[model samples]
Target: MSLDIGDALRSGIDDLTGEDGLLVGSVFLLYSLGSLVADESLSAELLTLVFESGAYTAEQRAMVDSFGGSPFALGVGLPAAVVLVVLVALAGELVRYWAIRSFAGPAETETDAFGDRAVMAVGLGGAVALTTLLFQSVLPVVGQLGGVATTLVGSIVGPLAGLVLLTVFVYLRQEIALNDGGYGETVRNSFARFMDDPASIVILLVVLGLFGLVGGLPSLVAGLAGGDAAVAGLPVTVLTRLLSTVLGAVFQTLGIAVVTDAYLQVRTSARESAA
Candidate 1:
């Protein structure tokens, strides 16, 4: 009982354009802020590292030293970074919410399961943040220590592992969004559903990977373009960042809908097979 990947993608697109635009819009705004802040923090860290590496003379070092300790740059933008994490979490949550509504039918009342959804959002967001932190901090150190083989293995394994984990998350999130379920119920249902029809996991990963690849082009172009011409480059980079964020939101919503649709179809197929 194979899932209808094409139909799921079509439904996903329709959901984003029709019913889920506002949710996707909010996701874009939140994701853009997070991306911008994360970039700024990374730039500050790089500048500091360059200064500390003694690549420059004392005067030159002094010039670059300013990059190390601005209010926003210092401690990696502190409260703003914290806020960005929350925003990222929200972005993750809204996509799932939109998907659940589209697939399972919208909530009958505005107040329906808001609290539970918040819990699910926080959980998903925490997982997202943790995954990122490990990729940023742990992976590099491990790569350096393990050399080329380790780096190569990680490059292959990391994304595959992340994809698997993400599907699990999606499974749980679907229950949280669609069912009036507790954490326990969500966990059980997600695991049960996936175990019953494992192929949908692949479907989800492929769909998300394709969409993410397409969505990431703007950021790639932005980073590649924009030479030292600060006047030309700044606006171009800024616009591209904005565009990337918007694309990100679009795909996030689309991914959720696609996965949910896959899940629903898979569930039906599995049930029919059992019958």
Candidate 2:
């Protein structure tokens, strides 16, 4: 009943190159671009408002003011920017439902279950967002306690907590897509799956993490460079960001494929053993 990592990876690669995979990749690309625009615009406006209000520390204010204006603007206020970001996120979630079902290999007769699956996807997304928010909300309180031990603990625990949440999320997606389970059942099943084969999950996560790091290099370099150079009168930073966005889309799509394949392998093994 153990996972065959090599077979799963090969199957995943096949899934990623399929026609539906291209659709998933395209949706991810649009989502990435939309999020970048909305997030940058919102961040600039928030910083400007904070700076003008002098609510931040003097040092923080000075650094932000040095930008000479907003780092990015879309002529939209914070409220509008928030709405745009939410819309983009919702769109992505809807498309992701289809992608997940496609990966799960539903029968043609099950096409009518789209509404149910879509609702489950949205519910799952909301639950994850709330969980993440709650987790992050604890960090400031820990920081305010103000001790080196607390800081060290937070640094170590934070990444581990994030990784656990991510693992749960990945398996939960597959469970919801492939099984007729509600939120609670899916959550429990995902946890059980992790407990049953933690090593396989860890290996899959490490592989994905390496791929993500490679995909993110362009963006990291551009950020470190501070975007000082221009090529053909276009900023190198812009070009790098564009390249990073594309790579991110590809990486995300591949991750989804690989995880889905791995989940199916585990599920099939369990079923055969039961039989």
Instruction: Please report, in order, the local distance difference test score of every candidate based on alpha carbons.
Output: 0.59, 0.68
Best by lDDT: 2
Write candidate 2's Cα lDDT for 1-275 as tens digits. 47877877777778778888887888889888886777667656655554555446798566544433333358598789757756665666666667777766765213457787777767786566445533443342243244567656655666567657877666776776667766788788777777667788788878888988887787667655555655687666677777877998888788888887777777766667789
Evaluate residue 207 in candidate 1 and report its C-alpha lDDT on the 0 to 100 scale.
58
lDDT (Cα, tens digit) per residue for candidate 1, span 48-130: 55455554579855544322222233345435554555565556565556546555565422335556576665675456545
TM-score of candidate 2 to 2 decimals: 0.79
Backbone clashes counted, model 2:
0
Q: Which stretches of candidate 1 lie over 4 Å from their true place?
A: 39-87, 107-111, 136-138, 141-160, 229-235, 269-275
* Per-model TM-score versus the true fold: 0.69, 0.79
